[model samples]
Target: MTIPTLEDSGQGTGTAGEARRLAVRGDLTMAHVGAIAGPLRAIPPAGHDLAIDLSGIDRIDTAGAWLIHRMVQDWGAAGVPARVENASPDADRLIAEVAANDRPVPCHVPRGNSALDQLVRIGNAVFVITENIGKILAFLGQTLIVLAQTLVGRRPLRWHAVIHQCEAIGVNALAIVGLLLFLVGIVVAQQGAVQLRQFGAEVFVVNLIGRGTFRELGLLLTAIMVAGRSASAFAAQIGSMKLNQEVDALETIGMSPIEVLVIPRVIAMAIMLLLLGFYGSVMAVIGGGLFCWVSLGIPPVSFIQRLQEATPLSDLVIGLVKAPVFGFIVALMGCYQGMQVTGNAESVGQRTTQAVVESIFIVIVLDAFFAVFFSALGYN
Candidate 1:
């Protein structure tokens, strides 16, 4: 039989300016001080007296003593009479430690071992900026190189790799994107219907569905999906390579790991994203059409016709254009994080998490850029 135990049993009470007693048990460690401080800080100034009954304290440490001293100083500063009662001999010895230190304590700062320290600090800062700038430049340069290689290959194009990438990015991801876009379409249509009915303009639901889904939802959903999928994949792949020393093996064999691994993954992702965008747009439109038919009595043919009339060719162009850029970013970010993976499983997990977060950030920022750019170009 198992029974749950109560965690805390301390009680405090009664009247202004009266001493309140606290029963502290278990280990008298720094962690214990933290727990005690939470309730102690909340006590009113009128009844600010605190007494720690440490008779139940089985083990005490230096951190516990330091905490007590700080608390005493704080109460003294606040004009609250704080006293220690029932301190064990060990606790008394710890309290004596602070009293015996008479000299003015120096501030806690460590001086470095000379010129190399300064050089190392400066070099580290420079190296960080240089490395980040280099990553952007390298990513762009590598992207262009990969695209050019695909476009102007003297040998036949590697249809096999491209096909595999398509399967990974597009086919495997279809269910998730479709389901989400369908839900998005339903929500957008429902919201549009409510407001449209107010103005007796429910027929315009078709326009809302077409413009919103085709132009924004399609691109946004595709980007978010790809970012999570590809960025995580990259981090995991690179982290595994780092952990298993596969990257080192490649270097030893005089092969560029970037050219071999990064390029293929990026290319695959880019191609897959574009296809996913197209697929998402179709699914969203279908979902919105279903909503229109059910809620607004609009037939599918009329909805399509309304979408054709309300959404311009340029909107389609804008949506399609965002996909490739989003794809490139997703792929690049994944590869970058993968390459940045460190030597341990924990580090791999950390970098993978970082990659997902960073990729999503980059995607949103770039989407804002595209939104502004297209607006300026009269394409929105």
Candidate 2:
């Protein structure tokens, strides 16, 4: 095949104006583009009409078509009439594609007013939050329906899966949960003692540790830790299943993915969170009692006695009630985000991170609501 060449014929008057004709010959593919591109673009000032002849092109590809399209656009923008002529069907289609895609990208320009920009951002955030709330509520409704069906014996519960999840979420987390709460308890007791010592009321440190652990710190911290650990795991596990089409496989076999995968996890999280919260509270109390005995000269027995007298049964009840609700929220966020995953591994990772962050945020928000609610009810 001959190398591509661009030949400029002498100018002549046409219907529009004086016109310069450029003839492109031979195969107009990537291999020949470098040979002809410079000469084609080196034409005199763009005052005259220009016509590019492609009829002599034996072969053409996207690269050559783009070059021709660019030259036409450059001259056209400079007040010269420019167009491709005598192009074969394939060449015309390629050039048309190149021309169609040669559009300027839109750029974002910042508004001058900072307050208006802030308001716009706030509105967008509110819109996104409202949409996500609706989705989570819908998912909650579906989960409750499936759970009710299992309770009524209409659908079988997978006991083995539930047990496995319980072990993973609760039993495996015992060491970390116990250790962290113990440290928190020591901090609370030491701080309380320091403040109360000035007033000669150091013994009241027992009240601080006992009421705080039983009512707030114990369950709240447990839920946050579980959200970080188990919520991410649930999202990753189910998201991987989604990526591999295993969730689709279950549906194709007439199995509900919610029933087979989600119900057991939700049940296990609720049950384990309740138990873990109680265990963490006990560990915290132990640490507080140890601190009192060593630092304040308050014996373990006196510490136990003061704690029993100071902390109400209502405080324990409040913590217990909130544990399962927090657990359900964490599990729901994880499973819902997992089901929403599509496309590839990146989606799984993104959903997993979203599940963890959202779980923790929602848990803290609910914890605040519970605090206000119990306080109004005289539980404080």
TM per candidate comes to: 0.65, 0.72
Candidate 2 local lDDT, 37-56, one digit each (tens): 88877885454688888889
- Candidate 2 lDDT for residue 198: 97
Best by lDDT: 2
TM-score of 1: 0.65
Tell me how many residue pairs clash in candidate 2. 0
Each model's backbone clash number? 0, 0
Which candidate number has the best TM-score? 2
Model 1: CA > 4 A from native: 1-134, 146-150, 154-159
Residues 1-380, model 1: lDDT tens digits: 11111122233354574566656566757655566656655654434476656676777778767666666667767886677779898798997796566357669887878898989999999998698768877877865776676568732345676677678778889999999888888888999999989999998888888888778888788789877876887788887997899998998998667666776777787777877887898888899899999878999888988899999988888888888888877877777777777767888888788788877888888888888998998886
Cα lDDT of candidate 2 equals 0.92
